[model samples]
Target: MMKIVADENIPLLHNFFSDIGPIETFPGRELNAQNVGDADILLVRSVTNVDEGLLKNSNVKFVGTCTIGMDHIDTEYLQQNNIAFASAPGCNATSVVEYVVSALSSLTESNGLNLEKIRVGVVGCGNVGSRVVETLKRLGIDVCCNDPLIDQTGLVSFDEILSCDVITLHTPLTKDGPYPTHHMFNDEVLSRLKEEQILINTGRGAVVDGRALKHKLQKQPSFTAVLDVWESEPAIDIELANLVTIGTPHIAGYSLDGKVAGTEMIYQAMCRHFGLPSRHKAAQFIPSPPLSKLYFTSEAELSWSMHTAIRACYDVRHDHYALMSSLSGTEVQRSQAFDQLRKSYRPRREFSTIKVLLKNTDSSMHSQFKALGFNVKSA
Candidate 1:
């Protein structure tokens, strides 16, 4: 039997891959050369650093990460050593999009601002960003997109995106290249943000300079910031955490559906690489959602009904409060708490899992709900 090493935090590992081989589990951050030395396959999340240091003496032939981002893995080294690797791209795109919508709903409600009147600027047009743009547009919300790499006509400039009512980032972290994103929002760019503008980052933490952001928030105080990712994460700045409107341990993509989908994607890849018959599917492994159905009457306001339904499925405030309450000790303690929150994250299903029953609703509203990935039923 083949030996497999996997991150303990990854969901549905045993259910899907246990039939293939005996799987050894470890905390992603604690995975080292010694622990993975004799394994034939290694599976991990973003917390593990997969490099030559960890695999130099290992017999690991295949590596996979059940996460969207790949910054934690050294692809160059893996390629040089003839190790096959795979990452689940776009698996969590819907989850992140739902997070942005939930945050915006809470932000607008608290501030007494009209959602339709706000212009949202999406900074990256990849898998996650494109979904955000599509969802916002379907709701009659104005959205401007900025992605230099994509060749779509009428792409907005970066400067135009900066001046929008809300700015959300979904770009990867790149430090040294033609279009580097590391510190993309430096002091100069951050200074340009108006008091009315709200900034939300669900992308990589280092994309924005954390120290600069903290200092700017200290001076401005009126600038609204919603941060799900931070620089030097796990040890993220406490002051910045306090300053942000909504702060969360990096778990925007922790939805049970998304995590299971990621695992399934990588599992199929591994099975194909080894020419084994793949027998697992994500839908079969997903458990019943906490909120399975919501009913809306004819008198229900479209915006209110939508907001209530989305929040019912997964509310962002629960996570925000959890992070705020966890960071009450020394830096190391806070760091441990941050990781613990992620490890013990509760099961959250996506919009599609919940069915919305609408009475006397128009075709437009029904179409909108369907477009947002909701199961819509007319009564």
Candidate 2:
């Protein structure tokens, strides 16, 4: 029988594939070759680096990642090591896009920010950014795009992105490229931003300089920010987290449907490559309880309803802000603060988790969510 070892973060794998082979589960950090010993196939998330260091003397022949991003995997190394690897791409694009749009709608309503006339710029028009652009355009918003790699395939320039009313980044963390985004938005670049514009980054964390953003936030007074990913991950900049309009612990792609889809893709890939039968099934997604009838029908009511819904799922901004505010004096203490909060973060409901509830105002809205595979129920 083939030996298989899977990362703990991957859900519902054992029950789906237990009869396929002898399987073992370990924490992501414990997936290094030394720990897994003689496993023939290794399944991972983005956490376990599948580089030479972790697999030098291992017997692992096949590697599969349950994630959209392959930046964590060393493709060149895997190719040289004769390791066949696969990743589930575009699986969580819709999930993440929905998260960004819903969050934006909530932020604007709560903070009274106007989106009607706002010029939105999206960087890196890949799976996630492309969906975001399409959805925003569907909502009748002005949108621009920037991606040099895609520019070779007929994309716009970054200079045009700088002029937008709101900028949202979705590029990968590349340090050396024609359009290197590692620390791309630093102090000098940030100085060029308009005073009233908003900035949102749901992509990689290091793409934006947190310290520089804090400096800009102080100097540029009128600017606002929404960060879902932070530099150094669980060890984020406390002061910057407190100042942003909305912040979250990189859970933008954590929708229930997305997770299941991503895992199923990987499972199917494994079965196909090994000539095993696929038994993956579509999971039944259910939405949250309906909200009480609105007392007043203002933007305030809509804002409050959205806030309650979002908070009911998970409120990363308020909770992280509170964590940082209550930190002890030392930098080490603050670092520990972020780690504790992140490690202890409760499960958040992704867009798929909330059954689609159309407020009866728009028949189009009902159709929209249904098209996106949501279980729509109109009030």
Candidate 3:
């Protein structure tokens, strides 16, 4: 029998991968060589760092992270050691997109900004950014995209990206490259942002210089910042958190539907790595959301109705509150609570799980809702 070691936070590990071996679970950040020494397989989320220090003496032959970003893992080392590795790309793309929609709804509702009227600038047109562009356009919001790697029409320059009414980041964190994303939005970049513009970063914390962001926000109270990810997380910048319009622990992609999809993706890869039959699927283990279908009355205005429906499915404020409430005490305590927030994050279902029942809404709304990833029908 194979020996497996996995992160305790990975949902449905036993249901999906138990047949392969007996599994041991540990906190992802605390996983050390002693814990994984004899294991043949290791599974993780983004928190665990799979490098030589932890796996140097281990019998672990296969490694997997159930996350879209692989910045935590040392891939070159894995290749040098002949260890097979896999990451679930685009697994939580929809979850992140829905999180954006919910955040946008909150902004539009509170700030009296018309969703259809404002332009949204999306930096990095990867899995999440591309989906964001598609969804925003579906809602009739003008979208400007920027990704240097891809050749596409209508891709905006970095300067144009700064001019949008709302700018959302979805790029991966990179330190060294021709276009390293590390601190892409630094003091100089943050200074150029309009005071009335909205800046949201769900992609990576280091993508924006947190200190610069804090100074900018302090200088301009009207500049709205909605941060889902942060620099030096768990022990995040307290002053910055206190200053931002909305800040939360990185749970944007922690929706139950997305988490399970990540588990299943790595499971399939593990099965292939070990030459075992891949019999399990993600849908088998998913449960229904509390509100399966939500109906909007005919009197419901388009923007208000859309915001109401989206928030009803997944409200971003609760997440913001959860993080703000938990962040207190010493640095270590705040860090621990940050991890705890992620571990005990309230179960969030993706928009695809709930059907939006539109009545009194324009027939065009059906395609719009569908474009936003919700199953829609006439009520």
Point to the candidate with the largest TM-score: 1
After superposition, which runs of candidate 1 have C-alpha atoms over 4 Å from their true positions? Answer: none
Count the clashes in each prediction: 0, 1, 0
Give the TM-scores of the predictions, in the order they appear: 0.98, 0.83, 0.97
* Comparison by lDDT, 1 against 2, better one: 1
Cα lDDT tens digits for candidate 1, 52-79: 9999989999999999999889999999
By TM-score, the better pick of 1 and 2 is 1
Candidate that beats the other on TM-score, 2 or 3, i.e. the better one? 3
Considering only N, C-alpha and C atoms within 3 Å, which residue pairs clash in candidate 1? Answer: none
Report the C-alpha lDDT of model 2 over 1-379, residue by residue, as the tens digit.
7888888666667766677789888767557667656887888876678898887888888889988888789989999989888898887787677666666666576567676768889988988898888877776678878887774544667888988888889988888867788999998889899877788888888899888999998776568788878887556777777777777666677665566677788888888888888875646332342432222122234435444554544444554355656456676776656555544544444544456454534555444444443455765
Error of 2 at 348 (Å): 3.6
How much does candidate 3 score in TM-score? 0.97
**Span of ten consecutive residues with least summed lDDT in model 2:** 291-300
After superposing all C-alphas onto the true structure, candidate 3 shows an RMSD in angstroms of 1.2
lDDT of every model, 2 decimals: 0.91, 0.72, 0.90
Error of 3 at 88 (Å): 0.5
